[model samples]
Target: MPVHNSDIAEAFRRLADLLEIEGGNQYRVRAYRNAAATVEGLPHDAARMIEQGADLSELPGIGEDLAGKIETLIETGELPLLEEVEGRVPEGLAEITHVSGIGPKRAWKLYEELGIETIEALRKAAEAGEIRDIEGFGEKTEQNIIDALGRFEGGEKRLRLMDAEHIAEPLLDYVREIDGVKQAIIAGSYRRQKETVGDLDILVTAKRGSDVMDRFVKYDEVDEVVSKGETRSTVVLQSGFHVDLRVVAEVSYGAALFYFTGSKAHNIVVRKRAIDRGWKLNEYGLFEDNERIAGKTEEEVYEKLDLPFIPPLLRENRGEIEAAENGELPDLVQLDDIRGDLHCHTKWSDGKFTLREMAEAAKDKGYAFLGITDHSKSQTVAGGLSEDGLAKQIDEIDELNEELDGIRLLKGSEVDILENGKLDFSDNILAQLDYVICAIHGGFNLSREKQTERVLRAMDNKHFNILAHATGRLINERAPYEIDLDRIMTEAEDRGCFLELNAHPNRLDIDDARCKMARDMGLMVPIGTDAHSINGLETMRFGVAQAGRGWLEAKDVLNTRAPDELLKLMRR
Candidate 1:
């Protein structure tokens, strides 16, 4: 058996919990949390070392007393300390201690009184209104548990991208501050800039990895420790999302990160390239003759393999490696190149800003124009406008256009494509608008074929200038309804309608892959930050970056055109 430090660390972890129950120093109790992290991130097995005659005291977080306890376990095959505590306190009580509204003292009280040991029991008590009558838990507290129980019962524990950032950003900086940590980068979907993230994956390089993971598990934000092992540690944040930290040596930092933070397919292509050139690839690096060579940074990894550094989004294995090897990778888009937003809503619909305020904010960002695409009448829930409402809004747009010198206000509507694929408004109404981005707001359950046909019909609509949020994926939660993207792209190419890359994080439609496919068909894409508020406009940066991953150039995007040119293209 690889002497599992996690098994040993967990034993000590129980004592640490008991210490909290006995009202021990908060910092002393924190030592066990710290030890858990240290054990988790050590690249080499400390338990094996302890078995091989290395003292546990040599480990950074394991103190003399903790070391003695580890020694005792190695000799006697049992931890008297943890077993004694287990005798007094019920087994698995620490596990129950993580319920959101329940603290350590309350958890101990439950064990001493009601003998609650699992989420099910707690839910039953709370739902039966037994918890509200507990000393510290009030009606509000009881209600909070009831709600959290619904979440707990559902077996869903992922964090939203926004929530993950709230925690990961600070810890990322803190890990960098540690003296031994040479490099750290966020891997996984967060790095891909997905609108929704389940958990955060962080990769770090350190001379003191054992010390680092120990410090990491106590990340001030971590509410519960999940597992700790050498070179890896997993923890649950107060928000109930798990974050996995992997520690590698400084020398292999880049290669390890590139491998671990993966879309999987991207790594396969890169490794195939190495094999073609008589090299083997792994987290450490490309190796030949048992001698490590190639890659100290992500850029170096690509350069050594003779290719461009692929961005996280492009790493989805969409022929980028082959294209790069041939020196034919399309010029990817960049954040700075974006100069305008075309799909935005205003208070006229469900947007938070007025038309002028949204436009002026665009101007401040140095954009040349703003397209006000408020929801059309079919979207009643969003206060979608009728013909007269649109006309009134257009008048305000005209007035705003006059107030600005160079910037133009586009009179546009995100008209609903009724189930049959027709625009919400009549042709006369559509003709009066500068552009129409017809979208699907309902009929989410349509079969893939019907959905494709529905969108195809809208794409061929003479007045429809863009097929907005094609597939309509809400990232992490909603699977985009199946659309024969081939048919939609084919129809889009036949007509001159631009494909909308809705830049709202929740809807970065035409995602990275579809954008490449569309560009391959010579269809122009318009990367629109479907900005509904000033802050929403910031998503344009990711939209642009996502396009870059697909090797998109400015010419490939319809929004890159000047107002007159864009108007002409939309009219086409």
Candidate 2:
């Protein structure tokens, strides 16, 4: 097995978890966690670098000792130190930490008080009313544990799209480098640019007697080969993602791609249409009485069915086929249509780069403008700015605007909407900026009506221009708190404020369904990266992909307009 960067990262993370549970040195545990983060976020394969005999210590956050451990894991697929730590700590206790609201300390406490080292044990304890008797746990905490356990049993967790890309792209490149490969693509939800994917479907056209399957199973990241055949194979990557590869003839490549790249609902509707036309559609080709009609290209497949071609992103069975039949399909938003970013951070708060650096990075990306919307005083953990601090930064931005050319900076703040629905800063202070991005950072446990009302009252403020991360969801980590989105959308439309499609991978909060709803309500949506670093700006592409999935066009996105037009809309 090839130890990819993620594998090494996971090992380090597990080591840190075990060490923390064992009550080891706090700083040492933190070092391992930070090293894991840095390794996981690397743009290239660290394992490949090790293969080439590169020095791992040069990588960020990886010291000499950590580098040696990484090399050992890559070389042996095992870390003796991690194994020893596992010996001391109950491995199931680590699993307990995965439950929402159960941190390392909490897991340790559970093990100490109840001998509950596994999820099943914890659930059993909670259900039997044994957990409520423990210190710091009551009826509500016990119920929360039970609820989280139920959610865990509901389904296998899915990977974020970007993480899937990290695994798939390198594997695709390796496949294309094979001796007889001709064409290749990663199909399924990845092709549709879905927010998360269950697995990857890879399709390839190869020459006769090609060794693509052999090559695929032999890849370094293949932790397990579930099945392998001449034309099709399924393998589990080291990162726990399953991949299915199919080697199809060139003649049937198009049909195979279409068949595999589906929202099952979309595929069902398309197949029904073909059947109504006296044609059979499957992975091989579109057929009439065993004679192939069309299969070489997706365009031809759609043409044979007398329907316009549909972009993969729009194939969600959400009236897209009907719209295509009537020639009413939207001109979906593309990556190039965005003109600027309306919400990003800088060194002024929690961002990684300085203001000038962020501006230069945005300018390099051909953006006409960028907004510096750091957190307000409430997010002190993120170094949120005080009123006086914001005043000075506003002046600094004005100075940068005069010095800079080709790009403009908008002074703004990601102001917190307090529990009672007041902006973090006063109206007079907020009015000094070009715009504001109001958000909820705390009090996620409020009731649906109160949460909705809190947001409604905040949006009622004149300075509340955009609602950031409307639901405050963190994909696999946290569920969106209870809130009625319909009333919020209605309020946003009537108030002239916009909603943000936050582009961060963890929080694509205003999901596709909500984006369509906002569009239908005739509200402008801004695709903000909520970026904190230079590389973070590139997350805009992910945002655009999400917008495309939502059936949005350039006209529906606020930041697609030129700076003057965007400012004019803001002033409205």
Candidate 3:
């Protein structure tokens, strides 16, 4: 029943969507959306902060009014404003807005014109060719909606890794505390650090007569107990996320973990290797002529298969088994390998923290340096710096650098790559910065060729150091903008430019596959947190996990180098 940051963020997002559909003020709607982002990015639970007597208003984008509302939500399990807005907006209208190519305003227009408030109603209208008659919505828009609906309906609902973490970690802690439980760990895709997970698989080791299953089914957050047994149980949490728990004896613990924590394809290939050796392998143990040989640990199982232990992140059957056999498996990047974050923001832009605070936070995290890449002039909504403003910031950074110790702040701008492939700032202004991080802030619907050309042209500039986000994706909320990433990687390699693995949970852009592509193309991938606040810096671990999954080693990441070396590498 604890109110997590994700829950608060979801409430704010729902309220914003409903208010937008109800024709609310633009700034007010934006405030809620930004608040949702801030809340979602927070590393700690808002309810726990309040419990510890911390002021919620101190959080970025959270004002006195928003903080009071958060308190109401945490204390009363409801947000009064959200409840009020939900009453004013047609419930289905908010859902309709979730469809791609449809915004709240479009949803409202659809409702006003055709009385279409539900997705099914909209689908009926689109299929019948009635939607194309709407003034602004033409045949193309109608067809796009039908296609979008097909995808929307067919796709399974899965939680983003971070949201699932917020739910699963607490449940994990609960299970680990059970009296007779000796071990508890989340397995499957969560173990492999995938961006999104369908369900949680928990494996536990417990003593005989342990009541682990009984206690797991009675957990506070469980909405329903789907099935329960002595060794295994399945439950659904209040958020509609499902979990399965299995209890195993200590002897078979590792084998159970190995089987359950699987990319099924990886397991299949390994099992085939065992079969070729005239042995059988499964959840309980590896067998030779019905005599148990090895299964006491995952290492034992791997050793018996004549393979080195494969990291969970590389268990996607993506050449990892072959690499392990040949001893060519990468050492893989770890969270500790990161020395600094190359992309973050300050109060100079839309970020909540000042330069000094962010630098100190970086120092606190043991980073040797932190890049302060505030927004360029084009992102006015994010308080993007004007030419004069950027000049002032560059000067301020020089002065702060002189006063600061232990950590260096690299001067930079997240310069927008304009639709026509022009940098937002002139080269003269860009020359003043230590480095540049170019990104696309708009024009997500550009054709693939145009998008690729835009990025390529931007990289042609000498000041371009890193391609931020690379693909402008927002996990489940938005698809990656169309572009030939292989060509982009090739161009980046040729141009001495790097691609970013933006670590922000919502925008783990340039996803795992692209990261691997960059690696194979000999491109250095910098894992930038795109941090807007101090707490936002904690997302670095998620980025590292993603990089590991992509087979990146320490040498493959840009920020893994020392301050001087990283700066040298950034120099074109």
Best by lDDT: 3
Instruction: Report per-prediction Cα RMSD to one decimal.
Output: 16.1, 3.0, 2.0
Instruction: Give the least accurate 10-residue stretch of model 3, judged by summed lDDT.
Output: 148-157
Would you estimate the TM-scores of all the predictions? 0.68, 0.90, 0.95
| lDDT of model 3, residue 87 | 81
Q: Count the backbone clashes (under 3 Å) in each candidate.
A: 5, 0, 0
Cα-lDDT of candidate 3: 0.89
lDDT of 1 at 317: 79
TM-score top scorer? 3
Q: For each candidate in the order shown, give its overall lDDT on alpha carbons.
A: 0.75, 0.87, 0.89
* lDDT accuracy of residue 88 in candidate 2: 89
lDDT tens string, model 2, 1-572? 66776678778989999998888998899789867756755556677777788898976457799999998898889999999999889998876876766879989999999998988888899989998888898889888787767655223578877667777888999999998999999999999988888898999988898889999999988889999999899999877889999999888888888999998899999999999988999999999989999988888899999888999999899999999999999999888999899889887887767899999999999999999999999998678999999999999999999999999998889999999999999998998999999999887667789999999999888888999999888776577877999989888888888889999877887999998888778888899988776767888888999998888999999999998899889874
